[model samples]
Target chain A: MSSPDSSLAEQAKAGDLEAMNQLVAEHHAAITRLLWRFARSHADLEDLVQETFLRMVRGLPAWRPQQPFAHWLQRIATNTGRDYFRRNRIRDRWQAPLPSADDAATATQPEAVEPGGDPAARAAAEEVKHLLARLAPDDAALLTLHHLEGWSLVDIAAQYGWTVTATKLRAWRARRQLRALYLSVTPS
Target chain B: MNTPPDPGDSRWDDLLARARKDQPAPLDLAALQRSVSLEARRLASARRAEAPDWTALLPFRSLVSSCLAGTCAFTLIASWQVWQWWQVMPWAQWVVASSGGAP
Candidate 1:
């Protein structure tokens, strides 16, 4: 996987326009997922995804091929989203509570399907997203990647340049904090 | 494979699964690809724009840009004035008068 991504990245860096387009399409879904993990609303997701690719274009010239392309791309996407939140902090504060994910979960949910997309399932999804929104950005992202995406502590730590022990400790604390919040919100 | 959860354990896994199911809205791949292409062009143009213009031949890019801009402005103004002069007095009539023909 890294080999192909690396080759594609190399071509893109060398100004192969088709290869760049292919790379954009190839990584779009994963980047979209990563954006979804942090973003509260789905309204501006396409713009965010577009911004992610745009930043990738700007950063690809200075990219080192030693590290895997996906990792580098993910880092760039994370930074792009972080910058977006930073730029929009005041606007977001003035805006109404985000209703996209939660409302979407409720609205699109089908009746009589006990699968992962049923109403209860979406409600659970809504709860988790709401919980994530309540936490700090870093904590929210860590939990989303680890719990939702099953990224290992080592992998998460590697992305953040933290020791595995530190990652584990932080994840534990974050999970406890999440649990307390969840219990407070969800009545037994 | 369905892993059975112990009775006492919290069911966060199911919730995690549900969260994972709540995907972001589907994106238009064509639009993204188009944006990527557009960005490539934008970057190329920006690079070209940032490149020092050879005509200025000056070490400082700002001065070069300004000089080039001034040259263009002067050229445009000069061109417009010349056009106006030609409109007011035809060069052919001036040539006839200078050659001692009827003006």
Candidate 2:
């Protein structure tokens, strides 16, 4: 992810606004999705996304080429999202309504109808989202980065400044906890 | 005999596929570009104007402030202690000191 195009990076580092915009344009969608997944609501998501870019712009001059730029960017975004959640925890305390009977029914339905659209698959996604939503924000962020984002364990380790073993262990523990929670709440 | 499928593996694979497929439509890149460029200009201007002298001054400021605070606190305590000692000391000491220790 290190744009070995030294010219581009040099320009970006030198505060070339076009270069900076280009870099953001390349990864902004993924960053937005990642932040939205971590945030509790759209407004929080938007704020975190903006803050992430602000931090990136501020910290760009200090960035090292040895690091994968995308991973660093994601780490900043994750931390910014985490910080926003921490600061706004009280404000977000309005409990979301539990899944209704119909929602559960829809989830449990089989996916045999659409030859391409996997209903069971869709159900699993919905289940994962629901289960993740119930967990702590940090746990959800960790899970999304590792599991949903499909980042390698090493990449996650570097992103979070954790050892590979620690990342793996935490991911394992989070999955186990999530499984227990999912089963207890929505007995399959 | 039909082999039983691994439920956990199947579930996670399905979920991953869904996440990958569920990307929202791409944003308006032109609009993003415009806004990002505008922001970049504003930031660059601000950076030039402020030069972020605060970071350069931070350590010195912190050291001076801490030293001043500590000195003030110590001075207050010392002055209070001296005033207390003088208050408790006998009047004989004051009379002798008044005669420059001759009396």
lDDT of 1: 0.72
TM-score: model 2 vs. ground truth: 0.60
Write model 2 residue lDDT over A16-101, tens digit each, in one string: 98788877787788788787555543445556677787788778878877777787787898788666655554444655555554
Which lDDT value does model 2 have at B97?
Answer: 84
Clashing pairs in 1: none
Residue pairs with colliding backbones in model 2 are none
**Which residue window of length 10 is worst by lDDT in model 1 chain B?**
B1-10
* Steric overlap count per candidate: 0, 0
Q: Mind giving the per-residue lDDT tens digits that candidate 1 earns over A11-61?
A: 999888899998988899899988866665555567788888988998899
lDDT at residue A123 of model 2 (Cα atoms):
49
> In order, what DockQ does each candidate have?
0.24, 0.12
In terms of lDDT, the best-performing candidate is 1
